[model samples]
Target: MKKNLVRIALGLALVLLTLGHSIRLYQHPLLSHLDAITYDARLRLTQPGGQDSRVVVVDIDEKSLAEVGRWPWSRDKVSRLVRQLTDHYGVQLVGFDVVFAEPDESSGLRVLERMGATSLKGDAAFLASLASLRGSLDYDGQFAATLKGRPVVLGFYMSNGIPQGALPPAVLPAGTFKGRNILFTSWRGYGGNLPAFQAAAPAGGHFNPLVDFDGISRRVPMLVEHGGQYYESLSLAMVRLLLGNVPVRPGYAEGGSGSGYAGLEWLDLPTPRGALRIPVDENVATLVPYRGGQGSFVYLSAADVLQGRVAPASLQGKVVLVGTTAPGLMDLRATPVGEAYPGVEIHANLIAGMLDGSLKHKPPYALGFDVVQVLLVGLLLSLLLPSLSPSRATLLTGAVLAGVVGLNLALWQSGLALPVAGVLLLILALYAMNMSWGYFVESHSKRQLTQLFGQYVPPELVDEMARDPERYSMEGRNAELTVLFSDIRGFTSISEGLDPKDLAHLINEYLGAMTTVIRHHRGTLDKYIGDAIMAFWGAPVADPDHARHALLAALEMQVELRRLDAPFAARGWPALQIGIGINTGLMTVGDMGSPLRQAYTVMGDAVNLGSRLEGLTKQYGVGIIVGEATRAAVRDGVFRELDRVRVKGKDEPVAIYEPLGLAGSVPQAVLDELKLWQQALRCYRAQEWDQAELQLMNLVRLNGDCRLYQLYGERVAHLRQQAPGDGWDGVTTFETK
Candidate 1:
């Protein structure tokens, strides 16, 4: 109970730490990636735009520039363009991509000056001409009247390092645009504020890309830094006009912090369908739907519309964009779609998206999502260590990893923005902590277990046993495992000449080295018989890979013995050569004998077969011989079939395999010789005397004095003399061990 309480306290502490970090670093721009990820999710959740085909663009293309002679065309021409779009094409609203801040330069004012219109009489004539010129310019009052009741959105830019002036009193939103407070800095120039032109359009949006320092356009701010106070961007203002309302009036009558605008929720956009809530970034720039290409999305040329080149049906109700295509103008931006995208087109997509009820929002429930993740991981982690056994705990650990991945997939499918890295890190941290604490509490028993079995098993397996003592016992049991027996050839002679004390010391040294190899391969030492050692798998702890472990142990022991030879030679001792025999079958394996005299061991027919094969290893003249059962159990393919033999006390003919180094690293000659010998064995078993004699002769020449070959040759010679009958089963009875 106390452990559970401690775990809960730790989980709560981690959650609080995460919460504090988020709030403290909320204002930093680096955290914007989270918002970026959120925006991407929004796009996937929302529907595609261009559903109603309400908004359209009257583009200004190269052909139009050719006909009208360069950009910034005379206002008289713009006024006509506006009039045609409204009156002829029946276009409902006209939004200008072009801004007119300065007064009309070509208003013929210079002509009046050149004509010397200084007095009142001349001034009156000049004024009449100016009025006519205004009338001829882009539908000034004529277009304004059309936009009165209908929805219209205009375009403008914010100062990069300065601020745009407040709207004139005549053009301000009635109640919202109060108090005639104006501040001007002459050093910073504000462009695109043509008083007469702006007055004509009902509403406007800012055409700006919130480009980062690295020139990557990621986020857009809803409020722009203008003058001493923040002003809503062009998109926000346009949305307000679409809703038949305006930005909320800030009631800073006392002149403290601006709390009056706190209740402002979302700007509503006006379209042919109806007013729609258009959620936006702090600044009006839309999250670019970058398609990763230069010319990814469809870009229709505006020149086709003016020349009657494009089909009428194409522009009948489709949203068209009117923006500059000139390369030098640099109105292009890097968007999610492409590196060079027209800035004016992004707003068109955004407005269309907003009108179709396709905008996405995360709301404030994202915090709740984080809380859920912490609770899930923490609870699972806290329960795992205290409740599960070691092996079961390991299985649960794997399940936890899989569970995390599954949760992430589910949340993504549901269109939720779940924090990934933070939650996963929390799970990992908690898991490690619990496991460490569990180890700490059981350290004493673990230390004792390690001391007892450290020389008999790998350290990793020792740690596993130490983690959960209840799962394992030294009691005996019958299980299928591979047993290996190795005996040094001619060891009796060497020991016979040595002093007894020196011989005992040397044997201990050799056994110590061999025991290390066995433990490294996860084999439990069974016992020692004079100059021989016995080991078996599936003891104290069961290894599913028992056969593989036995084979590896044999190979490693050979290598270690070779390494020991150099040092032994320096000490005037003969190099050691040993033969190992391995057999796989069911055996009673565990701690046996009386309580006061217990030792880990295995006993069964399989164990006896292993000992008998070790004796036959001298007759085969091989370093290691493995029964067919053992070879089949090995996953590493390290053994090659040698022959079938009937050992003493065993009636069944057993296939034997020679442990030939590693599978891939064996020498080609060794493999070839083994194949030749295998063919000879097949011939001998088939009673094909001539073929068997020829193959056995080749084998004897390549590696002479093998007891099986000598024995076979003597039998074949006798068979040639006696002419044995077909009743012979090709069985060679062995009187061995």
Candidate 2:
């Protein structure tokens, strides 16, 4: 009980920390970013992907610029487009995503007037012509005349720079929000339309989107303040105009005032159908409920509209937006849906969401809800996890995580935008804390056993020993095991060519690589003697496939040594080669050393025979040599019998084989060659010198670089000259160790 108390206290502290981040008592940047990411993921998953025809973007694309002249085209051209949209196509509402801040003077009226005042003064023909062309030459007046008495909403922009052009009347009057503590996006200046355009429309809205800290434009301020006056966004203005110019009113939560929180939650617009509520966040901004990618709404080229090339029914009753998609105009935005999304589409999505009441709401009470959620989930996990076993704790944690994600998604589908990152992170933190505490603090005896055996055995075996520590020790015992020995060929000469420092580094690298291969194959590394390595399997933790593991490790050691060739040459060191031998038999294993310094090792005749096989690899011209027992134990292994030999210390001859590879992995060509070699060896043992010589000649023709074939070829020739009697056996005896 006392042990669990510390973990419980630590878990609770994590809960409190996450709670602080949730309620904004303090902010965690990583948690906030994660919340944004999760919100984007949920939004994308639930978005209805089909196109929405209710809102359309009249794009000023590159095609339009190429067909017409460059941008800031004569106002007469723009006026014609407006007349075609409203009179010919009968669009329901037209909102501009672009602002006309300067007057159009491309009609040459100013130049003609100046010439009349100076260069061509008092010329009667010129004066009459000028007087007659006055009405036709006034382009700005033409554009304003086209805008009058139409359901067109001009767009403006807000900023902190100096005010430019003219602003329309505010949506909320001065002093309307005097005592309220609503947090609106405030600006000091704006770039509005010209006076004539604003007066002709009598309704204009700002097109400035609210860009978050990560540079993604995810929301727009529905009501922004400029010089103590509140103005609606272009999307809001168009929606109001479509609903018969409904009055905008602030909607607040009922019980917020009691807690001194009077933040506005939504904007209410009373229509004939009902009161349409547009949800807003603490900054009076609403999330843009993106329907899909860039083509969520239909896009018709502005040039098509001007030239009467568009179908009339496509624009009928459609709420149209006029904006540019031309790259030179730079109206692209980084959005959650795409990095290069059209800015005009943002307004269209908002207008569509407002009409359908699908705008996601992140109300002020969401913070309180987050606080409560963290408290419930964090406390439940904190108290329950410490008392549960590991498997049960994992299952419980998984269930809680699923529940949290599921509930959050459900709320998201219902138009709520509550954060889920804090609670999810809290659950994971608590689970990890409890699990780590249990492993490190409670299992002291297992840790001691791990420390003792970790140096000699692989970590996997040590983990198994930890499960039942009483069964494993350094005490010596006899066990049927497989032992391996590997030595670097010509290591003495290789060391003589390099400096002492270089040699030391080389040996460390070689030893490290070979040891890693041994551990990877589940072999216990017994020791390293100079440039040699010794390892064994089926001790400490017994493996049923000990012979297979030892053979695999020996084969891999040679391959690993070859991999060092290029790097060694690059460092001015010689290419390295190693010979490995593996044997399987009964042997003594465990801690075996003097009292002065103890070591865990293995010994017996099998160990000594394994060493002898490693010494014969150079003579056989093979990388790995294995005794008969190892080759027999591994039924899946492919080996070519090298010889039957009696070493210096043993009188009984043993068959030795060179491991080709695993059965399926060995090349068919190599297997065929091995068969021919076996035939030749059988003939040589039978004293059929002529047949053996013929087979050796064919093998040398196939591969002239084979040292084994050459060595046997010399033996056949020598034995033909000095033939032994039939009483002699076929065993080759090695007199040197």
Query: TM-score for all predictions?
Result: 0.43, 0.62
> Tens digits of per-residue lDDT for model 1 on 1-737?
56467765675565555444344434234334544444444443442433334555455656667776677766556555554455555554545565665455565555554564445445776667665665444333444454454444556666644535323222223333234331211123234555544565566555655776445564444444344434444545544555554443322224332444332223444455654554443233334433333332344455555545655565554444467756655677765444676666655555555554554333234556766766666566655555566667667766886787577656654534345555555556666665666555666777778777766667778877877866776667788989999999999898887788877877887899999999888888878888899998876777898888888889899889999886777776777889999999989876678868877678999999999888878876788998888888875675656567788888898878787776788888888987887888788768788998999899889878676678778777788788768887665567868
RMSD of 1: 22.5
Q: After superposition, how far is residue 388 of candidate 1 from its true place, in Å?
A: 8.9
Candidate 2 residues 1-737, lDDT tens each?
67689888999999989988987988898898888898889889999988999998999999999999889788999899889999999999999988899878788999999999999998999999999998999999999999999999999999999999999889998887767888889998899899999999948999889988778899999999988888999999999999999889887787232434568888899987788999999899999999999999999999999999999889999999999989899999989899899999999999999989899999787988899999999999999999999999999999999999999999998889998999998999999998888566648889999888899988888888888998888898999999999998998899889999999999998899999999999999999999999999999888999999998888888888889987788899998888888899999987877789888899999999999999999998888999999999999999988889999899999999999899899988998898899999999999999999999998998889988999899989989999977976878899997
What is candidate 2's TM-score against the reference? Answer: 0.62
* True-structure lDDT of candidate 1: 0.63
Which pairs of residues collide in model 2?
none
